[model samples]
Target: MRFGIPLLFGCVVAGSVMAVSCKRGEHVWTAPDTVNIPHNTSGELIRYGRELIVHTAMYLGPEGKVATISNGMNCQNCHLEAGTKFMGNNFAATAANYPRYRERSGSIESLDKRINDCLIRSLNGSPLDRNSHEMQAMIAYIEWVGMTVNNGAKPPGSGIRELPYLLRAADTSKGRLVFDNKCRECHGTDGTGKYDSLTKEYVYPPLWGPHSYNNGAGIFRLSKFAGYVKANMPLNNARLTDEEAWDVAAFVNSQPRTEKLFEKDWPDLNTKPPDVATAPFADTFSAVQHKYGPFGVIVKSRKKH
Candidate 1:
């Protein structure tokens, strides 16, 4: 499953820039050309890093050649286009913004710490040794991807978009309908996703069940899931409305998945995001309210304090 080149979907080359079409009226961002990677040992590491991201499951999954760890899902499954796509959870600013405080850990985290967070939470896998070649390659690729971004600045479309909260709690029934109609073709009716045996990876990653992201993964949050869906779901034909996105997210997340308990997360309860989907809240909102929100009230209450 290793590839010499990184995956670049729906991109058009103009001069030296790669323009990827985005949501209507959104500014297009340029991804650095892989062609520019130097033909040296450093470039080899960078290329290996891209392969690690694009084929993470092959190298580091349950039956991985490197290690038997992650839940058989590639990092690109969520990061999208090896973390290059705009508003598609791209890594456009990650390199420049590390050693920053994250309320989740309540401490300043290095880039490797953040990568391990994704390994532990998103991939539901054990952390790669920070000193390992795999870890260094991943760091090299991510840093090279974001080298042009100014330090401490998140460029436009660096992460998931934020959709306004629905006036009502997101409806699973409605979400099921949206999933069946839009998502089932690739992800399957059971939401098990389509596995490509030849490639030894999922063509479409599962939305839920034992193999999907754990409860603590960022996409487990309805807002993040909905926003990600709105921007880049249903594969090539992303056209879900905000309401549809929110509902489908609720539907997908409601199904069973692995759970991760992190006692240290949100040490300051007040700093927790509104859609954590777990308990021990600083507010009086029910777990249901936190998970499937008519979250305007919860949000408003948080703002006043």
Candidate 2:
């Protein structure tokens, strides 16, 4: 089980650089803060940088499997720890080279489009809405990461990551009952999300155990889980009310999950998974992010729901 951000080494060379004003379409040189990285390999900071990269790799989520399968995977699965050199496919630099891409979406693509490509092609999932906050957040996060490491690196798809933990006091019994009543129909009485797994190939993975995020993934918080479920649950029957989503989350997460740590040649044991830091609410995502509160700025789209 390995999951983490991709790693980059050296520097990537894109189209010839031409200085331009701060205008959006210009190639203005934006220097990165290289203070933390050392000027020389023997330097202390360099060593730390290496260690940081290795450790940080552990935080990356799994890479996406082709969306045709219900594997319940993300890009972090394959490019484990940003291609920390273990089992990654090394596509970190692809970000800088895209927006000029020609893929299944047709025409050129931006970084977001590329990410969506992976979503549709590899994750067996639908593309996120173009202007969604989640989409934008993911875009920003990935771009920022791509700029790091200087060169192209990807993490391995070993399903290993420092998952944010589910709160111990989350009242799994309440969650369990809610799950049994509302979610069990699709997720299966066993909480394996087996319906999706059977309907799609590797598209919908079980929420716990070997197929899903390891203990390191710790995707136990309610908001992140609820958001995903609310936005896309019931196997193409999305459109869950916010409260319902929260209740469903309580139930689903209440189920049992393995505690053993996954070791699939992670870049570093010291570093945690990337999502752990960026997770909407981290360990206790439910209480903080949102539960039965105001769901302002919500959208009502007319899809297959």
Candidate 3:
């Protein structure tokens, strides 16, 4: 998470010296402020995009106008700080690298496609119309953040920073204790997150329940959730060790949420991530192992084949 000087002044282009600022990092990307955007249509759209992410449930949940595709969770639940904060599943580099090939879908995907994937899986909801203003706004916001990032370059701290896998399976029994001590305060004893009455929204979103993310969500995958928990759980004060995060992630994911909405996800079975909850996999591992995992064995086997 090193930093480079943002401001630079130089060059005799048209006999003028111009000052420019650069965003640089290897493990952390600090997104630019929305305040810097001019008061124009593009800026308005970007602002709307940020709102859509932070308040996704209000716009696309059961009561939304555009569509009702997701469970009640907001997109910000996973992509923390409206996709700005590093190691919090930030979107600082999404715009630059997308419209690229993805093995999961086995096609070159656009930014809207990726967002729709989240809507379909992570939010346990349906996809947005690609041409819809809502979709366009979300894309605009992501593009604004990563406009300076070069294509194919995963800027520092662009995505979730996964922890090294443990030698043994993550223990949910241990996770229960960790949840009691570290997470219960905000996320609640039953793991149903707290609600803010005045705002009429969840303050601490549920980790599991009818309102939570579905089995197809990325967080349902142990490694992804574990890494996220390690870096951003406990509500702005992340203190879980890597192992503890893994265990807790297992515990939370094990609880019932929405069922998998679609079956035909990974077209290329070989490229499927080990933690995908879909069954009838290419491997002989048990479903329990796939869900909670001592996943290293599966990973190794895949490499050998």
Candidate number with greatest TM-score: 1
Q: Residue by residue across 63-170, what tens digits does model 3's lDDT show?
A: 665677777778987888888876678887798888999877788999999999998878777899999999999999999877767888875456876677887888
* Best candidate (score: lDDT): 1
TM-score of each: 0.91, 0.32, 0.88
- Top-down lDDT ranking: 1, 3, 2
Task: Flag regions of model 2 displaced more than 4 Å.
Answer: 1-171, 195-203, 260-305
Give the candidates in order of TM-score, highest first.
1, 3, 2
Instruction: Output the lDDT of residue 89, model 2.
Output: 33
Candidate 1 lDDT, tens digit per residue, 1-305? 11122234432223233233334333345568888988999999999999999999899998889998888889999999999886789988899898799999999999999999898888888999999999999999999888877799775567888889999999999999999999999899999999888778887898888778999899999999999999887876678999999999999999988886888899999989889968789999999999999989999998898
Model 1 worst lDDT window (10 residues): 1-10
- TM for candidate 3 is 0.88
lDDT value, candidate 3, whole model: 0.79
RMSD of 1: 5.5
Candidate 1 segments exceeding 4 Å error: 1-27
lDDT of 1: 0.86
| Reference-based lDDT, residue 134, model 2 | 45
